[model samples]
Target: MVLDAIYRGELLPCENNMEGNGRHKQAGKEIEQLLKDLRNNLSEEDMALVDQMLEQTLIICDTECSDAFQYGFSAGLLLMQEVQEILRKRVDTAAHGVF
Candidate 1:
């Protein structure tokens, strides 16, 4: 999910170079770090899925021509939500021994 979000965030809708500078770059870097952390912690299978998602998302993001920042922000939030959901589910399952 983090990977997907990063890819989505990276892709821009415009040819403007400004869209890829400063704030957007910082956000992309942050997202990349989070994705790395997630990769380190998840199971191999999960990681593989995430990798695939990330690849697809990145392709989309690359071509996106408008609202790159907004898309990036949204992707970051979604990544956060995905991580939270994963952790919550893991904890809940561990506590209850059921899904």
Candidate 2:
């Protein structure tokens, strides 16, 4: 997937988000670091799960969103879902480890 290539540092994100609004000046570097950090912190199995979730979420966006506005909303929802799921699992893990 192009997204996976971008995630894996095989591609850059829009040449530093040069043509986009509300994008960081160093968005590409930021994403690269973000992926690196994630790899460092998450186990290989968990990382694969996260990657699968991301792909599934974007697949939903491809089918469900008809316009840029809707696509943005879909993507945002996917992000929220990803964050919430990760946090929920973290909480569950910590809770279990404490007992």
| Candidate 2: tens digits of C-alpha lDDT, residues 34-58 | 8789999999999999789879986
- Badly placed stretches (over 4 Å) of model 2 are 1-18, 24-31, 67-99
Give the whole-model CA lDDT for all candidates, comma-separated. 0.81, 0.76
Give the alpha carbon lDDT tens digit for every residue of 1-99 in model 1: 757856789643354566648998898899999899998899999999999998999888766634666788799999999999999999999999886
Give every collision pair in model 2: none
Per-model TM-score versus the true fold? 0.43, 0.37
Quick one: best TM-score, which candidate?
Answer: 1
Q: What is the lDDT of residue 36 in candidate 1?
A: 92
**RMSD per model, one decimal:** 20.1, 21.4
- Pairs of residues clashing in candidate 1: 11-61, 11-62, 12-64, 12-65, 13-64, 13-65, 13-66, 14-65
Off by over 4 Å in 1: 1-20, 66-99
